[model samples]
Target: MFKRLAKCIAFANIKGGTGKTTTCINIAGYLAKSGNKVLVVDFDPQANATSGLGIDGTTIEYSMYDAFLNQCQGYDGIPITKIVLETSVENIHLVPSSLNLGVASMLLQGTRDKTGILKRIIEPVKSFYDYILIDVPSDTGLFMLNSLRAAEQIVIPLDPSIFSLEALEYLKTYCRDIEEMSDHVINQITVVLNRAIISNSTQNSSGKPSPSEEIESRLKELPDPVFVVPQSLLIYRSQQEGLPISHYATNTGKIGKAYEAIATHLSGNSNVVTIPEREAEYAS
Candidate 1:
């Protein structure tokens, strides 16, 4: 079981352009709006989380990179709040990422056990927030492993395309690896199909590929996803505006509605999981 944990979830996938950063922002935003104190850690070197919240990425002196190295070298634990910058929303804060983060995997390998770096660094800060959402890079590498090890669960966003199936297959293998590391009990990874057509059910109207069905069947061999994120152009535009949909009060558009629903799902009110039999097994 994960110790010192308070609902840590990572928005991750090896492939890019799958709405990883966009999903991370909205999820953290809704959680904070629900009166839950939330921290968003940008694991990617790109610093999308920082920019998404309107923080100048270049101004961040300390990033996740420092936090990991500090732990590896036996330095004093860095207070997360020191690195976190307030967003327009009161309850949500961010641990910004740096361009230097691009080389972190290489730098981390010789420094210490890279896989558990994030896990150890985050252990102390878990109690500070009701939820900690990590926005990871869109690639399977040493860096991704560290974030996965730290996560209590995983959230994957798919763009609902043909190539996405190939990516899902790879993720299934990744889940197995995480399971093997943790005594054969895989951590829950929810797959969310983003940017999907609204009317399309499990199958597309054309039957080329019903994103819901194609992904669900592939994941059936692994774990079932919680739900699909319907296509919403407003969500994309919100990110471009450097603000959360909730903050854009005037635009009570599709993206805002979808994010609210996602927040509801993440609140753990529903019995959403791969194996219901194991739900009680993993309940904290």
Candidate 2:
């Protein structure tokens, strides 16, 4: 049995460009800024989450790929603690990914317990952090399967498009299948609407509901509340500069607040409290 002390949450979507990595990093930044220890496991071979937090994957000697392969070969995997690197954000660390991780699926193909590899790799270090956020690749393969099996909760980022909505439905089915196969039951699944355009005039111009409105309408039939992260130049700038929105702008900034609200909600805090000391801790 896996003993998990940290809240393992995965930001996963089958479709790309849904801001999965963006949401994972910013929320983790806010959580870490709040003084909670957080670890981000960059499960995607692209390593966007690794670079977005200002770490270069190429420079890392060992990565998630090594850990997964070592575990599969019945060797004590590279201890997750040894692979963890501190990010620019205080209290946040990362287990970066490399292009070699792209072949991880193939490596695990003939393994006896392929789906449970990640859970075993993370089990030893799970007690060391408050939250462990896994950034999964945009696919329904073994890599994504391991992420889903390892997480206690799943956060799906939707881009407010028909394709994204369809992908959500597919993910829901996949989750059900996973539940049937594993002992771990994913108790909570949150849907976050990213890059939402909230303009009534824009909706009227298109003779249809705006992206936000359309997503809201679709969400009413779902079990989770849709948190909105508005489209903003500041958010784009932050990403371009390889910083979390909270690090790029003050917590009071519109984009920053959106992430904070989601972070606070996920943390189950009824009141949002600002830790003044942490504000300057990671300030650029």
Q: Report the number of the highest-TM-score candidate.
A: 2
Query: Which window of 10 residues has the lowest lDDT sum in candidate 1?
Result: 275-284
- Model 2 lDDT vs. the true structure? 0.81
Q: Which tens-of-lDDT digit does each residue in 81-117 have in candidate 1?
A: 5677777777998888888767655554346665777
Writing each residue's lDDT as its tens digit, candidate 2 over 1-284 gives 75437999999999998999999999998888888899999999999998998897668988998888777764445777789898878898999999988987776545677888889889888888999999999988787788899998898999988899999999988888889998879977888878877655545776686766677677767766557676778766777777777777764455687688778877776343222222222232
Stretches of model 1 off by over 4 angstroms after superposition? 1-5, 73-81, 182-186, 199-223, 271-284
Instruction: Go through the candidates in order and give each one's C-alpha lDDT.
Output: 0.72, 0.81
Candidate no. 1 TM-score = 0.81
Candidate 2 has a TM-score of: 0.88
